[model samples]
Target chain A: MANKLFDIIKSDLAELETALHESVVSPVATITEIGNHLIKAGGKRLRPAMFFLAARCSENFDLKRVMPLAVALELIHMASLVHDDVLDSAATRRGEATANAKWGNQLAILAGDYLFAKAFVLVTENGYGERVNNQLSRLLADLSAGELIQNKEIYKASCDTEEYYERIAMKTANFLAISCQLGAHVMGLPEKDVQALYDYGYSVGMAFQLTDDLLDLTGDSKTIGKPAGNDILQGIITLPAIRALETSPDKDELLSIVTNRDMTKEDLNRALEIVRATDGIDFTKNKVEEYLDRARNVLPESIPEDVRAAYMMAADFIAGREF
Target chain B: MANKLFDIIKSDLAELETALHESVVSPVATITEIGNHLIKAGGKRLRPAMFFLAARCSENFDLKRVMPLAVALELIHMASLVHDDVLDSAATRRGEATANAKWGNQLAILAGDYLFAKAFVLVTENGYGERVNNQLSRLLADLSAGELIQNKEIYKASCDTEEYYERIAMKTANFLAISCQLGAHVMGLPEKDVQALYDYGYSVGMAFQLTDDLLDLTGDSKTIGKPAGNDILQGIITLPAIRALETSPDKDELLSIVTNRDMTKEDLNRALEIVRATDGIDFTKNKVEEYLDRARNVLPESIPEDVRAAYMMAADFIAGREF
Candidate 1:
């Protein structure tokens, strides 16, 4: 499904790739190297894809005009990830050494700052309007605040579903939602249509994160690009774990494993068993389906059938994605 | 001289304080705490003062119109300093615990990012025009790039005076130049006057940094905030040290101490003595005077005499400042 959707906007993503490569080049060799390292690490480019898909809903979908904004979106995502790796002390991301691991924490911090500044340089160079600028600014604040909040919550067994939702909303959902809304907005869509795109992106984003957390527990290292149960090992209690805490028969043992920073492999295996024995996995899958349904249902009726179908396919692809 | 200049901008500076305090307050307790920690550390507020003084050159100056820009200038400066502390592993700044020291590098990184985003948010809220935005975007890139370059050169005894100048230009001078230009541009000043203000800011910025480097070698910890020879101890080869590398009779000894990251107290003391014996100290002082002269020379004749006097006083203050 993702491959089919990619085929629809394949050329635009290619242009974005070239633009992203060119954007990170700098006089400072270290910055350029780190930027290239991140670029080659390979992401799904979900935000840019969503941006292009939403723009396709409008008649005036000019790639030339919208390319900078799309690039800025991805760069912002990359910058946050670089900083996230530093905060997490993550050695590898997506099966590759992280910038911090490759070039120490100090250089990684500077490289992240460089990427962030470069994002703004691209946007301001294109003279993006106040709405885009304002949204980007707010988005940055939310990204960092969300990370800070998540950092503060690490190892807490009491981490609840509502808190989990708010964290994912700030960290992922709003970013995707804004990506779609901005794409629709710059293509001259009406307010109603823009809001619809936002809603669609939000639903998909929620589903996307739920799937990600699920894979952290269920997927193998080769497929997921990290060790199984990486988040739990890092003391990041996600939705599945939260649900398990509420419903697991062995709740006290699970809670102890979740709270202990030094849990053994046996502890991890047992915690995984406890979560799977309860309704936790099923509850999370249901939630993901519910969000994807909301996404598919929110596609504006005025959009051409082909574009609408593509959006639906995108949502479906997110639902079934393992990595 | 600094006290006299402060008296001139007293009320405006007071307003900027309130705005900066309010700007950093956030719903996240950690962010708010770190932000306030930075605010309480008490920087010189040199960037904002330069901005206000540049704006005062134009009759159209309105404090309300330019207040957000002023707040943003200071925020950018503060944000860079926060990140700088993390990069340097600095324990204290301005006689207070650095964010990294008190909260750890991870939170400090996030706090720095939060401050940076807040600065952009303030600017976008005011909708500053493309030129201002462009300069700011470039300013951020330069700031980070400067740090990266400087970080790369750490403990390299062969580092040259030219490289040192390039680093300071990117890290400090360009930021100051843009601050003055943005202030003048926002006040509807002519291109020539804007350029003049930029030059004035640039010259003073060079002198300011040169003086800072000197203080690190010559002034005691009580007056300079950090201990004397702190820069050398951190393996940061500044201008005076670069000069000593050129002209010191004990050049090999100095180079060995610099290259050896584990230099002892005797090595540091010997290195300091070598630097003081050469033209290193005097050469850097002469360079400071040269830049200050250029700064004073560039004050536009179109400005009122009293405003001109204030700008002169600001430059003079940079020349004589111990901290």
Candidate 2:
């Protein structure tokens, strides 16, 4: 099913890849180098895919017009990640050295900023006016706020589930929702269709994050491209761990292990064990499935059958994928 | 002369102050706190002043329409400064504790991103579309590139004079030039007037930075709001030091002292003395006057006499201001 969608959009995706590289080209050598490094250590391009898919759902979809918005969406995601890596003091991302690790925190900060500015330039140059600007700027703000909130909650034993949800909603769901909405918006689609796409993206985005956090503990470094328990090790308290903290019989021991700044390999393994021993992992998986169901239900009936089918397959792929 | 310009723009400046405070208001507590702190630290507001002055030069100066742009210009300046504080690991700015000093580098980084986002939001919300976005985004890219080049040159003995000019051009001159250009552009001024303001701004901005670098060596800490010789101590090779490196008989000695990361207070004093003994300070002062002259020469003849007089005073004031 995923392959069907991939095949349909294969050409668009290829063009996006080239645009992504071309967008970051700069007179500053360091910006281009660092930007190229990040583009090379690629993600799933989920935001751009969401955008392209949403755009395709409309009769007004002009590939030339939509291309800049698509590029901006993914660049925004990449810019946020580059900044996140600095905040995380992360040495590697996607099995490659991070910009910060390669060029130091200072240059990495500038590189992220350069990417952000380039994103804005591309959209503005293409004349995606106030709507795109307002949405993208607000998304950037919310993303930063998510990082701040996550930073504030790091290693706090009493980190609330509500807070965790809010953080993920800001960091992931709204970003994807906007990607979908903006695509529909730029196509001059009906407001109803745009809203529906936003809803679909929001649900899928929430599920995507939940699945991601779950995999951080359940998957191996070889598959995930980072060590297992990586997020928790960095003091991030995600849903499964929060659920474990609430429901585990060894709750106090688990809390102690997670909260310890000096938490070790043994401690992480044990914490993972304690979390797995609870219904935390099950609760998280169930939550993912529930969100994915919501996503499937929210699809606009006005979209063509093939696009609808592709979206359905995309959601299912998200639900079942190991990485 | 500065007071005359200030008096003319007093009400607009006050409104801008209120709007600036209002813009950074965020759901995230850290953003507001850091933003307010930076605002209260009290910069000269030169960028916004330049913007307002340029607006007033035109017949179409509508305060209501221009307010957002004014606020955005200053916010962008503040945003760049905040990020620069992180890069420099600065303890204080404008005689107050820096965001990074009070919070941490991580929070400071987020705070800077928040401010940058808020700047874009303001302009976009007010419906300043592609023209504003294109200019502002390019300015941002240039600013980050300036920081990158400056960072790359730190402690490098072979840093070129041409590179120093390019760095400062990117950092300060281009920012000021844009402030003037955007003001005229938004006011629907003729292209000739816009070009004139941009040229005027570019010249003054170059002089402003040269004077600033000069003050780093020649002014007292109390007046300058930072320790004398702070730039050199941080491995920044500015105009005066670059001049001294080329012309001073003690060139080799000064080069060694500036290049040594571990250089102490006595070393800085000695380097300052060597620079002073040469004609470096005199040479920089001459350059400042030359640029200020060019600034005065380029003022549009079509502006009101009062507006032209105010700009003339602005140039002289920038040439002579102690801080």
Candidate 3:
């Protein structure tokens, strides 16, 4: 299954790189310098993979027709991350210093705007519109709101799990679902299949994030390329941290650290131990694997064996990803 | 001519108001406060007006059907302005303290994102898709490039008029043109009519900015709701300032004042006087009025008299507004 998807990704891979590089900003004199800088920085290109894989499963699927949708989803994800870093005041992303920290918030904001414009332009030129275009665009709205809500709740040690689920669902999972759903719909897939992809992708995304959050607490900096406990440092209350704070005997003790700048490396290490010892990482990672299993179950048993492997690969990729 | 447009504006007022208010974002927990502040703080709501008016003139015009297109245009316009202020470090808009200044850059950036989300939601929810929705989304990409170009030219006191025209055409005029184009397309207008409205709105929006730039130098604070010559302080290189800087005997002196913050109130006043005396305002404003005339000429004489009147009124509103 992964092999077929990889072949598809290989052919148009250059197109994605080209569109992202050139369309990042108009040849405007001033903002382009900073815009180019961020666009050039590497990203994992994960969303596109999911898009290609999911679209190929549909009888209506056509890889040539769906490249722009794939690009659009990735671009929206990239644009949001750009803005999110500025909002988070993050110093680095994908292992490089961020646009905002390096160039100031003004350029970062404009650069993100530039990417968004490019994404839409790509979609329009490729003729993704009406129902599919509208649905994907609406998902962007939801994703953006989820980001804002997540930002608002960052470090609220007592933040509700339901809100946490809702926030992450919007910001991370829903777009993946939309990406999969869009690919299927664009190929003119049946409504049921499109919806199934959407459900599977959404749950998988949630699971991916839950595992990612757990890894932020347990994974090495080299493996993740992000500092361990960085989310907690930023006061972002992820699922694992939420669990540990709820069940731990030192719940009130952990509560003070919610806004406390005094949370040292020692504290982070200790919290990691507590979160791990309390089964927090296991709880979230288990939930993540559960979604991946469900996503696997959603695949049509009648799919060509090659296509089936690609879908299975997606499940494997999310499950095995260290970060 | 203005009276006719006003009559149309008056008679079909309720729906536009509902669309405008409906364009207001909902009470999402995080975005509720900041989002509403900008939405409720009324703009002239001109973007929506252009959209609705163009839809009304379409052969397949459905008055009730194109509301989302109208609302979406306004959201895109508003989002751009909110983000632009942060880029420009503008202190006030519509006589109120700006979103960035009031809420800090974080909230303003998030608020702009919220508006953008809402805009696309409106677009997709309106039952539009395919080329129309794709085309509308691409406008954002064009607009962002235009802004990047604008940022590049800022404080280049000797910037040429062509560059100025291109920037405003993209950043300001494109939204208006798209507003009309989408309006017509969504309402099932004849292809010829939709293109005509697009060109008409494009020309009118260019004219609108030309007059607006003139007003930046000459309009009173109470009338324009901004300090006369505020653009000079912000280092925005408007067309009038571009031309005047080229011709003034005190040209270097004027450029210095316009580009540098060291200029006193006296220097600011002198720069304004020089721009005025150089026929800069008249030059720009006359060019603006010419576009308005051209827009009027573009409306096919075969149009119903009422529709023609409304289109001309909309152009006049752009050309003649005090602000």
Candidate 4:
């Protein structure tokens, strides 16, 4: 099913890749070098794909008008990742040295800003007017606010499930939701359909983030492109960790290790054991299923059947992917 | 005359202040705290003032419509300064602890991003359309590119005058020029007048930056709100130092001091003395005068005479200010 969806949007995805590459070209050689590095780095391009599918579902789908916005959405995602790597002090992403690790934080920060500017330039050049710009700007704000909230919550073992949901909603879900909303909007979809796409995107995005957190514990470093247990090591309390904190018998040891400024290898190994022993992973998987169900349920009957099927398949992939 | 210009824009400036303060308010407490810290630190509000004056210079002056863009412009300037303080590792700015110095690099980076996002929100909320957003986004790209170029050129003793101009043009002048351009644009000015305002702004912005570079060597730490000779200490080759390297008998000494990663107080003092002793300050002063003259010459005859007078006075102040 996922393969079918990929095949459907394959050409649009290729066009998006070209647009993304062309957007990052700059007069500054170093900027071009760093930007191209990020572009060439592999991403699933899920956001752009979702955007394209949503547009195709609309009554007035025009590839020419919607392509730039689709590309802009992907660029925003990339820009956030670049800055996130800086904030996380991440050494590698997708098995490649991060821009921050290679060129230093100064250059990385500027590169992120450069990508963001280019995104806006694309929006403006393509005549996506005030409403779209406003939506994109708000997404930027939500992304930053989510990061700020996550930064403040680091290592706080007492952080609840609700807070975890809020953080991921702002950090991950909002952008995805807006991407779908924008795709529908640009194609002149009715308000009801736009809202439905937004809901669909939101539910799927939540499942995507929950699965990502689970992968941080269960996935392999090579397959996932970074070390397993990275979020726990960094003291970030994701959904699984929070669930484990609530249910694990060795809650004290788990909290201590997770909250420690520097955890030894033994501590990390033991914390992983504690989390795995609990229902944390199972609980997270169940939550993903719930959100995926909601995503499937939100498909408006008005959407084309094939588009709905593709979106459902995309949600399934997001919920079930191992890496 | 500068005071007269300020007097004219006094109420609007106050309103802009309120708007800026309100714009940074967030649901997140830390973001609000850090944002207010920047707002209360006291800047001359030069960008907002210039924007207001430019709008008033237009035939269809309407404060209701233009005030938001003016505030947005100032926010962009403030956002850049916040990030710049991080890159410069600046401890103090505007006679207060910088956001980076107070909150650490992590929060400071987030704060800078928060401001940029809020600036966009303002643009969107105020219905500044695609053209304005495009220009603003391009200006952002220019700012980042300029910073990258400056970072690359640090401590290169052989850096030439043309390179220095190019860097400042991107880093500083473009923002100011765009502020004027946006103001004229919002007021429904013709292309010719809008171009005139942009030219006027570009020339004045160049003079503004040159004066600021001069102040780094010559101004008092207490008055300028940062340490004197900071550019040299940081290995930033500003205009005066570039000229000094070219014309001073102590060229090698100046070059060595400027290029040193760590310069002691005595080294800084000696570099300052060398720059002062040479024709560097005089050369920079002449350059400021040249730009200021160009600014004055570009004012459209269609602009209200009083508005032109005020803009000319503002240029004079920029070129002649001590700090």
Candidate 5:
């Protein structure tokens, strides 16, 4: 079923890749170099794919009109990652040197700014209505605000599960929700249908982030691209860490290890062991399942079966991916 | 004359200050803190002022409709400053500690992003037309690319005088030009009048930057709020320095001092003295007068005399300011 869905959107994805390349071309060579570096070190292109799929569910989707928007969404995602690397002082992304690592932070900063401005340029030139443009701006606000909150919460052992969920919802889920909503919006779908699609995307996004948090603890370094357990090392307290702090008998020691800025290899290993010993991993997995279920349940009965099936497979992919 | 123009726009400037404060309020307290820090530091508010003045030049100008856009233009300027501080590792701006210096770089980056997003929110919510929004985005692209080019040209003795003008046009003049263009556009002015306003704004903007470059070389630290001659210390090759390099008998020595990056105060003083001895300051001043003359020449005779006088006063202010 996943393969079948991929078959349907394969050419659209190819065109999107081309559009992405063309969008980042700049007169400045460093801007081009840094932008192309990140673009070549790719992600799933999940947001744009979801946009295309949601448009497919509509009765009168226009590929040409929607293409620029799809590219814009991906560019926003890529721009954030470039900035995120600088903020995290991350040396590697997708097992490749980050733009900041290759170029200095100065050029990286400008490149990120360039990509962001370029994304808006695409949206404005393509004539997405005021509503979509406004929504995109609001989405950026939420994303940045969420990151600010996360930065404040770093290494604080007192962070709660609710705070964790809210942060992820802002940082990750909102973009997905808006992506699906925009897809439906471009199709001129009814407001009710658009709302349903947004809800579906939100739930799927939540599940995807929860799964990502779980992977940070349990996944292999080679597969995850960067080092595993890097989040805790960087003082990013994910759900698994939060749950372990709540339920583990070794809570104090684990907290000490996670909160310390200079945790060694042994300390990280012990922290992971404590999380594994507790119900943290299972608790997170169960939460992902719950969200995925909610996502599937929210779909309108009016959607075509094939379209519905593709969405379900997407949810499954999010729930089941190892890297 | 400048004071009279300020008197006419006093209430509008007050409203703009309030709007600027309101636009950056975020859900996160830190984001608000950092944003308010920059806003309260008080730039000249030149972009927004130009926007308002250009709008006033129109016959059917609507204050209520143009206010949001004026605010948006100012927000974009403030946002760029926040990021620019990060790139330059600037400790102070407008005589206050910079956002990056006050908060860490991570939060500063997010704050800048928040302001950029909020600027768009204003434009989007106010229902600015596609042309305005597209132009704003393109302006951002130019701004970033110009900064990138400037970054590349730093410390390079071969950079020509024409290149210096082009760089500043991208970095400063274009934003001012667009601010004016947007003002006329909101008034529903004819295209010819809009073009004239843009040209006027561009020339005035060029003069404004030229004066700034001259001030960096000659102004006192007490007035400029940053140490004089700091640009050359940081390897920024401004117009006066370029002119001095072209005409000074001590060209090789000045080049060595500018490119060294670790020049002592004695070396800096020697370089400044050499530039003062050459035609650089006078040459730059003549260029400013030339641009200001061009700006005055381009004004349509159809414009009201009061409006033309205010714009001419603006040009004089840019050319004559000490800091």
Candidate 6:
């Protein structure tokens, strides 16, 4: 079933590929250079795929309405990735050099700004321009504010779970929620259904990010397509770390290892082992499942069964990805 | 009349002080700590006042229709300031510390992004939402690209006049053009008039920047609110220097003086003398007048007498300003 559904997205994604290149890439300036570089690096077009697939799910969907929005979602995601690379001061993304690494920070920032402006253009060009755009601007604002907040909170060993969730929701989940809501909006769905789709996407995004935190711990560089444990090195405390700190008797013991830069290889191995022995990973996974359950519950009763075929697979893929 | 208009805008600006505070400033992470520090520090809100006043120029106009766009324009201006301070590596703006100076480059970049997002939100919420949005987005992309290009080219004393004009058009003129067009657009004007207003604004904006280039050479810091000869210090070959380089030997002489070190009082005096002795200031002033002439020619024929009052005043203000 997974392979069959993946086959469907591959074909639809091919069509989206043409539009993405044609509409988003411009010869205007070095922006197109940086834009094409980051965009073409081949990250999974997951958000756009959901938007396109979700349109198929709606009984009365408008593909034209959804596709531009789908394009905008991907642009927003790409823009954030550009910014993330800058803030993280990273060199590579998806095994390719980041925009910042290639063009320097100012150019990287301008590239991000270009992509973000392109997003605003694409969404406004689509119908439902007002609602999607205002919300998306607010959404971008929240995302950046969250990043700033995270930067402020970095290396602080005592972040509360609520603050943790707020950070994740703003930085990660909001875009997904916005992506799905925009999809439904473009389909001209009833307001109530739009709200439900937003809820579903929000919960599923939280679940996806929960899994992402787990992936960071357990996944390898080749599998993740980037360096392993980079987030840990950068002092990003994920859900697993928060949970581990909350539940472990050796909380201080683990944090002392995680927080201190003086730790040796043996110390890293011991800390990784201690974190594994704790309930953090399992706890995070269960939390993902809880959100997934909420997402499943909010899905509309009349969603087209054939269209659900693709969405279900996509959701599963998001939840179960190795990277 | 300028004082009366300034008084009017100052009084009305207080009403929007809160909206700007919430919509534009507060969402920035260092809203109170950093953003407000820059915004409230002595810089004039001229662009925003232009928007509000232009929006109120006619019986058909609703100040509300144009106010958000005004705020957006101001935000874009602010964003560029944040970035420009970085590019120029200047430590002061409007006689106070710059965003980069106070918060570092990373924070400056993020703060700029915050303002950009807020600006888009302001425009996205109102009139011809999509069309205006597309125009604004394109303008922003052009502006950022222009800045990047300027950073690269301003170092080259041999850059042609045409290249310099194009850069200034994108970096400085386009937004003011869009702002006027957006102002007319929110008033529900016909398409031709909107385009007319835009072209008029574009030429005027070009004149405006040329005036600024001249002022940077001849104006006082108290009036211009920054150190004089700073542009020469930064290696930016403005129209005066270009004209001087092309038509006289002074530009070559001035170009030789700009160095990696901050200009001393001695260097500034010598450079200023060379610029004047070479007629660089007069050459730029002549170019500014030509642009002003072209700008006045493009104003739409259908505007009400009183409405044209502010527009004409704006053009004069741009053309006549010391900087």
Task: Using TM-score as the measure, name the better of candidate 2 and candidate 3.
Answer: 2
Clashing pairs in 3: A1-A309, A1-A310, A2-A310, A30-B152, A117-B141, A129-B129, A129-B130, A130-B129, A130-B130, A155-A235
What's each prediction's TM-score? 0.97, 0.96, 0.90, 0.95, 0.96, 0.89
Candidate 6 residue pairs that clash: B212-B323
Residue B219, candidate 2: Cα error in Å is 1.9
Tens digit per residue, CA lDDT, model 5, B1-323 = 22666665667788888888887777678877877788899878888887887788777867888998988898888888888999899988877899899988998888888888888888988888888888988888888888888776677765587778888999999998998888887887788989998998899899989899899999988878777898887789888889888888999999999888679999999999999999889998999999999998998778777778878888878877887
Q: For candidate 3, lDDT tens digit of each residue in A1-323? A: 22444674555555667665665444564456665666577665667776776777766666668877776777787778889888878898877888888877776787788777667667767766566666666777787777767666656674588988987788788878887787777777778877887887887788778877778888888999887888888778888878878898877766777657568887777766676777677788788878888888886554557656766777787788876
lDDT by residue (tens digit), candidate 6, B1-323 = 23554564555577556556556446334744666775676355655655555455446866565667776777788887887787666788777888788877767777777778878777776645678777777787788778767665544664488887988898877877777777777777788888887787788778878878788888877778776776777667787777666666555666666543465678878877776777678777788888887877877777766556666776677776765
lDDT of 2 at B35: 81
Clashing residue pairs, backbone N/CA/C < 3 A, model 1 = none
DockQ for candidate 1, C-alpha atoms: 0.78
Q: Each model's number of backbone clashes?
A: 0, 0, 10, 0, 0, 1
| Superposed Cα deviation of residue A60, candidate 4 (Å) | 5.0
Q: Worst 10-residue stretch by lDDT in candidate 2 chain B?
A: B1-10
- Write the residue-wise lDDT of candidate 1 on B1-323 in tens digits: 23755676777888988888889888888988888888888888889988988898887879999999999889889989999988888888878999999988878898888888888888988978766777787899899999999887789865667878989999888888888899899998889999999999999999988998899999987898766898889889988888898878889899999888999988899999999998888899999999999999998889867678888988878887877
Task: Please give the ranking of all candidate structures by lDDT, highest first, separated by commas.
Answer: 1, 2, 5, 4, 3, 6
Q: Locate the minimum summed-lDDT window of 10 residues in model 3 chain A.
A: A1-10
TM-score of chain A taken by itself, candidate 5:
0.97
Docking class of 3: medium
Q: For all the predictions, what are the DockQ values? A: 0.78, 0.77, 0.53, 0.75, 0.78, 0.53
Interface RMSD, every prediction, one decimal place? 1.0, 1.0, 2.1, 1.0, 1.0, 2.0
Candidate 4 residue lDDT tens string, B212-262: 999988898666877799888777898888888988899999889888888
Give the interface RMSD of candidate 3: 2.1
Clashing pairs in 5: none
TM-score of 4: 0.95
Off by over 4 Å in 1: none
Chain B TM-score (each prediction, in order): 0.97, 0.97, 0.91, 0.95, 0.96, 0.88
lDDT of every model, 2 decimals: 0.88, 0.87, 0.75, 0.85, 0.85, 0.73
Worst 10 residues of 5 chain A by lDDT: A1-10
